[model samples]
Target: MESISITPTIINPKRVFKKTTGEEWYNYYAGFSDDFVSEILNSFELPKDSVILDPWNGGGTTTLNCALAGYNVIGIDLNPVMNIVAKSKFCNTDDVLMALDIVKYLRVNNYPNKLNDESDFLLNWFDYNTASYIRYISFSLQNKCNTILNSKVFSLIFLALFKLVRKYIGKFIPSNPTWVKKAKNSNDKISIESTKIKIDLKNILREKLSATFVDNVSSIGKERFYCASSTKLPLKEHSVDAVITSPPYCTRIDYGIATSPELAVLLGNHPAEIDNIRRTLTGRTTIDKSFLEIESLGLTAKKMLLEIFNHQSHASVSYYYKNFAQYFIDINESLKQIKKVLKRNGYFACVVQDSHYKEIYCDLALIFTEMAEENGLSLIHRQDFMSKFVMANINSKVKKYRDKITANETVLIFQAN
Candidate 1:
């Protein structure tokens, strides 16, 4: 099938990932599709030496697409789990098989790899045996075998562990798939049969991870992803040729809580570890006690903030107003960082949606345009597609706040001045 040369009419803006394979490693509640990234790359007809950057590299959709297209890509995310996941894309059969050989060894020997990382978070969310098995697999994957398994191989194994853990912790995940709750009911014993899981794990990892994606590593510019914050970027000044990223929306989504299960299963099992990450992210729910008054957030943000402050809805002034203020603050700082890294005349495309604080409209697209311009990014093009499905539409109670069934997903294209 021939690829769409022209950027398609925006549907959900974030996926239909089935169009591309191997990206189904993790289900992201807030990630754009590979098809969308392909269109952006094609439509822009970027320079041959162009280096792509996905600042908010949720689930590796942008980074993976860039790799397939043979562009040098860098994917960054604050969540450590995402870095492990993004790197998994770089793995081939050799890398995956090596990790599997280690797994085979561990299983055959019955490695008593206990979950010495006594985790209250896991205890509240998962059955002891289930969590222990997951921890054991993760620890084994992280082991130093013959000068330490290559980053790609370890990441592939870690991704496999995530797949296994997701099946056993079904009871904790709520209506919103991202939101994982604590303390399963005693009646609801979601126990994993160790024998069945071993079979499932082998089948899942072997079939998925062994398949090759990138045809030639030498032919293409390499992809590098890191567990880094977007606000404080790791790239050098004027290093990036283009930035293709969808910054977190101002909807106050807790990105940290969304990936709590992955964080608990692999990196850190403490709730504070999760909360600390949440506090650092751009669109996270937590608030700072000594919040800085941001003057550079632009006129559009100020007006929206004022409207939310005066709104009559419950908690509109106290909680909702403050939440949006912090988002704009972080976003303002991020735009500045983006401008610093983008080469002159380079392209920057951002996908954003409008939200509501009760009846007050938070025109995020307009706000972002203003903020980007303030940071030396000149607006070149803009397209708004009415999104049939949005996060707000999922909640029945949202109808009371606004009768509108859908939101507009605006793609703002800009050039670095």
Candidate 2:
């Protein structure tokens, strides 16, 4: 099949409602379309034994689609919450339903009063009693899982809990759609009794089970995912036939904070675990304040760095530059890792949107193109779709600086040389 231009909607996750099972389990903000991944499988000439990989497997879109099409696949993400979400894709509906019986043994009043600092993080969004109930259910599920099979069965249950937490906190969804914040007033926090929590979660599970095809139909083994950072992949050299994924956007979205509810559920009571993850994630707003000498950045990236550094806006040099620089460094290392694992002539397909450092255009595709080439991946195909102005919307003040440059949702295919 000859390659065709990708539709702009391929980058949008609006098709999530149109999905089932694991694809419908957790809808991440940065994930691409299921339809798009299906299209890629239909077009790409992947062999039956080909190992497809998504290093930044946000919401498992690429990996799930690849697995569904009967290919050996792996998905990796640093977020533990996503690890559960993605792994839950392999769960059987019968096993998931049977696992719900474990929850009956948990008594709301029996929860430990001695909460960890991280467990307390849930209190801001939920009341103490409700939070305790949540922790009780979470811990009960953890304790009951004795083997790998039970652990994965409980994962499907946790996916329901993850979704239920969001439904419980609908009032907390702030204007910035990316963030789910703690309500300012204590009265605004969610406080459902123990009975409702269990009932609501079970209802969600039952509804989803009836609708979703949870059983793994593929001949290949399940659990084809890992919880790890993108900069350091656990795979061997030249093991992968194709790499398809969208790394975190260069736009400083705090994915850690964006996914606090699910993170709280996965991390059990260790709330501060997110801090380690946030600092580790690419394009984090939190600057680690580390100085890195430029190595892998191409001329285009270096030039953009200089432009952002020279800008007179607040913290352009001290903060924004460092943030962008760190992103470049991390992405460059990830490209190197991608190159190392990809078989010779294996294709690395990426979907990245353009952004800005204040009024300065950060052409992510072009910047990534330079770094990919520097990392020994040669760009073979490029297509750009007109996109809504993201940075301008992110910072309304950018309008004063003649931010006439619009953003592009670009798809670039690079072959490992």
Candidate 3:
């Protein structure tokens, strides 16, 4: 038998992952593809029973891929919707057709005239008719009981159409640049047909759910997942065999604020509740200046924090950096716990990118490498990967700000000595 060597390619920072059919399955938040995860696993020579943990398992990519690879996997995230998404994506189902039937039924009969008045945030983002239709679909699925299979299928459907109601709407003013802004509207009479939208949403949901259903069923084994904060995972010291994750970029991307509007709508949370959610999120833009001062410990981290602090006339840079610094501190603490749980000689593969704060660049991979070394992990290999997906759009003023920083991303690999 011939031995096949596996080499992990360093991606170009300026290159974007080519879009495939499954691309839309993630709604632009697909953190990594299955091939990427598989390559990482192969490089590590991961054991079949190795316990894998992804601290920031956005959209369940790592969890699902790890499970299918026949490893015991645990995923942790602060976002409730992500928890739902992970669960739905990994839970096994016997019949996707039944799930499609449920969606079809809901689409036909659950068209409510109005949502509860308490849902002001939902009303603000979605037109009245669209909001009503979504409310009906959501209400129909609430508390419906079934096997893990049915539940996950329903979740996929709900999650797929979660943003359909407001897909073409205009951007919301005073939004965070890190998050995708809603489109702004110039006219009041935008021709949005409620029935057509619902039908299209239903069809898309069914097709996606069916594909995921077939793929998961065809797989021979399963993986486990956890819906919790990585900062405080449930694992014991030195228990895991490997850790692979890409922590959120510093203050550059606010996960909660970006996804809050959709979360608020799906969860039927009030505006007040949404505000509270935003506050609890790690990368939120609501942090006070005092928090920013506290985060200015790391030289680069502090420098960027101060720059944002000085330029307070435009955006709330302080709040972003403060939250970002908090996230880094949390990651450091979590890595310490991970060390305790990882077995001797275990490996940690981190996929991270450098981010811009004001005009300064923060090399997060390098910072984490130092932090991990301080905590008994040794730096073994560092590979640079190109991520064509630049955070700031080309023509935006922010582009000039980012131009001051490097335009590439890197991935670092570390091992426990």
- State which candidate, 1 or 3, has the greater TM-score: 1
lDDT of 3 by residue, 1-417 (tens): 112233445343231454443434545353656667767777777668788888777777677767777788887776766766676665333435565677666644435554777444455556666566666666667647543223566666666665464364434523333354433542442345667766777676656643452353345335555546666777787778888777766534566666755575566535666666556554555564443233323455455556666765555443454566666666677677777777788877777777665566667777777678877787777877656555554437766555542444566766776
lDDT of the structure predicted as candidate 1: 0.75
Off by over 4 Å in 3: 1-23, 91-94, 107-114, 145-150, 166-198, 213-220, 288-324, 386-388, 393-395, 398-406
- How much does candidate 3 score in TM-score? 0.79
lDDT of 2 by residue, 1-417 (tens): 123333222333223366444345666666678777776665567677888899988778787778777788888988877777776666566766675666555565656653465347677788778887787777767766643222667777888899999888877876565777786777887889888898888777766565444354646433377778889999999999889888888888888888888877766477667778888988788887667777658888899999988999888988888888888999999999999999988878888988777667788999999999988998877778776645356556767876465778888888888
Models 1 onward score TM values of 0.90, 0.90, 0.79
Error of 3 at 163 (Å): 5.2
Q: How do the residues 353-407 of candidate 1 rate in per-residue lDDT, one tens digit apiece?
A: 8887666788999999999999999887788878787677667888886798678
lDDT of 3 at 93: 37
* Steric collisions counted per model: 1, 1, 20
**lDDT on C-alpha atoms for all candidate structures:** 0.75, 0.76, 0.61
Clash pairs (backbone) in predicted model 2: 118-271
Error of 1 at 307 (Å): 1.5
Q: Candidate 1 vs candidate 3: which has greater lDDT? A: 1
